[model samples]
Target: MRAHIRSTSMHPSGNHIDAEVDVRTLSVALLSGTGRMGVHLSAAWAHAGMDVRVCSRRKEKAQQIVDALLSGQGYSTGQIMVPPHPCDRPAPSASWRLQAGRVEEAADADVIVLASPFHVMWRTLEPLAPRMRGKGKIFIDLTNPWLNTSAPKGPRGQTLPPIPKAEPQASVLFHKTRFNDPTSSWCHAYRHVFWMLIHPTGPNPRCGERLGVELLGDPRAVAVCTAMIKAHGFKPVIRPGGCEVAPRYEISMLGRREKGPDAPPAAGSDPDGLIGPFSASPLIAVDALLEKAARHFR
Candidate 1:
């Protein structure tokens, strides 16, 4: 995508900066950079020409994810990727750069995407929230409480983290308890389905499809986030009734899935062997989501 720098806003510190720059030039910070959604988003935002910072509890882990994103290496099966030349270095971009950082630095970005698991969201946001105050940053919640079920163990047989107990109302609970703030713009988005986040190499793999992403939050915040979501290659569906009814929309979308509404898709369901089923569920119909979103707007 071409970098388009449009509009500007002065920093709260009394300096001129493009803090309110359009999506094409927006800077993004993805927390849990090594997590499933974070890794994909880091690559997608970087490919979209946005300055991206991938943060992790351990800076080294963040660095590893960032390196793979920039170098296009070590991606797991089922992800649509364009691997880099074996001996070639990543071509530097004049408009964007990807970095490995911590939550403190991430909070200062134009867009802060919370991709950590829902069970850990509050803990993750505790320290970072204070730093984002009065910054006009947009916080996009990508965390979903996985239906209050026990998570399956990893291949090594280690038990995974349990899903958040706040099942159907996870987003509502999140905003009410930990993330509500008047200083920064925040919303629950990209939580219902994220299969479109695939193919981070760019050229918008689902360009013509215009997959709809349901967003619930402050109007001003949703508008800004809408632009960014569209620029990154998805249609933004603004759900009415603000954050209070976030759970309604979340349930509406998930319930419309062709298969596995109560549980997530099976891992490795993507025949191409790129991203896992949770990230890119094969049965998720983009057209159906758009249809449902259209009904909401009516």
Candidate 2:
């Protein structure tokens, strides 16, 4: 599955530019930098040649995470350029790939990776919506809308609760909030996929060359994110009908056995052991989800 990379070229006046946007040059901000997903993704993107900012409620926590990620890779403190202020942007001439900042400073980025827990997602982003709106920023929502009583950790290091039998379908999480804007687009990805499966240092994928990642959003935004996923070494399995039918994707992890009407068939084929007994592994759940969606929606 070689993804076709294209320029998501947007002009200042909301028109298309002929030149392609450099995936490496994209400024990415990871919200909740101390979280499991944030730690991995921030490092991954920074290593992939993107200017990444790991942002958190506490700037010190974000700085510590950034310093750790850099040190883990054998980079020294002398290589890092710590910003004097929380909102200060990295110097345009500086060559550092990763930095740390406050969550509100995420507005200065080209892409915002929502790595916060589902329970506090809206509360975290509602205020930042106005600052991020009309800025052509892409919002990558990796949060799952599980009705968890409390954040539960799965056996395989996944944050998942028991799949609820019933859930809402009226509006997808971001669409119901202030994030549904014309200038900026939101793409639902990394939801069902476990962090261990996609993280740089995690398990070696059972699937040979490509591991399918389910993506749902505007075509242009999806295309841009598809390139990003490909750069990170994962195949993008984009679902049709855009975000309108995102609710079906939201509960796809419940598997075929779920009694709820919203739960779509997990997958028509169980090639990766995704359709059998519940394992609570996102690798299986997400594989089953994208496989079923690829068949049904195609």
Best by TM-score: 2
lDDT of 2 by residue, 136-237 (tens): 777787776553533567789788643333433412444434466777766677654544344343223433333666677665566667667766676666
What TM-scores do the predictions have? 0.65, 0.66
In model 2, the runs with Cα more than 4 Å from the true position are 1-21, 73-96, 147-177, 201-210, 256-298
Whose lDDT is greatest here?
Answer: 2
Candidate 1 lDDT trough over 10 residues, lowest sum = 266-275
Clashing pairs in 1: 77-273, 77-274, 78-273, 78-274, 78-275, 79-274, 79-275
lDDT of each: 0.58, 0.59
Instruction: Give per-model CA RMSD.
Output: 11.4, 12.1
Question: Residue-wise lDDT of candidate 1 within 1-298, one digit each (tens)?
Answer: 2224465554322333332336656677887766766776666667676778988889987876666556655344233232332344454422348899976777767777877766666677777767776666667787665434324466998766443455335554464456556666667776654443444654234333435566667554566666666665665666566666565544332342234554333223322222222444334455335545554564
Candidate 2 residue 38 Cα shift, in angstroms, is 1.4
